[model samples]
Target: MQEFTLEELKKYNGKNGNPAYIAVNGKVYDVTNNSHWKNGEHHGYEAGNDLTEPLYNKSPHGDKVLSKIKQVGVIKKD
Candidate 1:
């Protein structure tokens, strides 16, 4: 898998023609094609962020939705 630093990960915010991606459990997932992640934002949750805490603690749907998405890479320890 590819390795990305926090700064590099910010580039894939699903905006301005960039692909949408979010990190969770140290893994990066491509949400660019996900209906819920359209335009890189979903219910105030934006892509290009480390969503580990929010997804695990706040989301009703949880990180289970990530199973359907592609695992693109891993975030380098900051």
Candidate 2:
């Protein structure tokens, strides 16, 4: 998989026709087609950012949800 820095990941914020992507467990997923992710903001979570914390602590579902979405890349640590 491709690797993306947090800065680079910020570009795909699901805004202005941009693709929506979020990182979970260091893996990046493209949620552009999901209505819940419209405009890249879902339930206070913004796209183009590592959502591992929220996914584990705030989400109703588990990481398994990412299995259904397309993984476009991985989030690289600084």
Candidate 3:
């Protein structure tokens, strides 16, 4: 898998035709096809961000939802 820094991943925020991506548990997922993630924002949770906490605490669903998406990269530390 590929590795992406937080800053590098920020470029894919789904705005202006860019793809949307989010990091969770150090993994990066491509959510561009999910309508819920249109424009990189979903239910107040924006893409190009580390959503480990929000997905765990705020989401009505569980991490099982993550299994459906494609993992494109990893969120690496600086």
- Tens digits of per-residue lDDT for model 2, 1-78: 989998999999999889999988888999999878869999988999989998988888978787789998888877
Model 2 alpha-carbon drift over 4 Å, by segment: none
**Each candidate structure's count of clashing pairs:** 0, 0, 0
lDDT of 2 at 66: 77
Best by TM-score: 1
RMSD of candidate 1 to true structure, Å: 1.0
Better of 1 and 2 by TM-score: 1
lDDT of 1 by residue, 1-78 (tens): 999887898999999999999999999999999988889998898999899999989999887788899999998985
| TM values, all candidates | 0.94, 0.90, 0.93
- What tens digits encode model 3's per-residue C-alpha lDDT throughout 15-53? 999999999999999999997787899999888889999
What Cα-based lDDT does every candidate model obtain? 0.91, 0.89, 0.91
Off by over 4 Å in 1: none
Ranking by lDDT: 1, 3, 2
- Lowest lDDT 10-residue stretch of candidate 3: 35-44
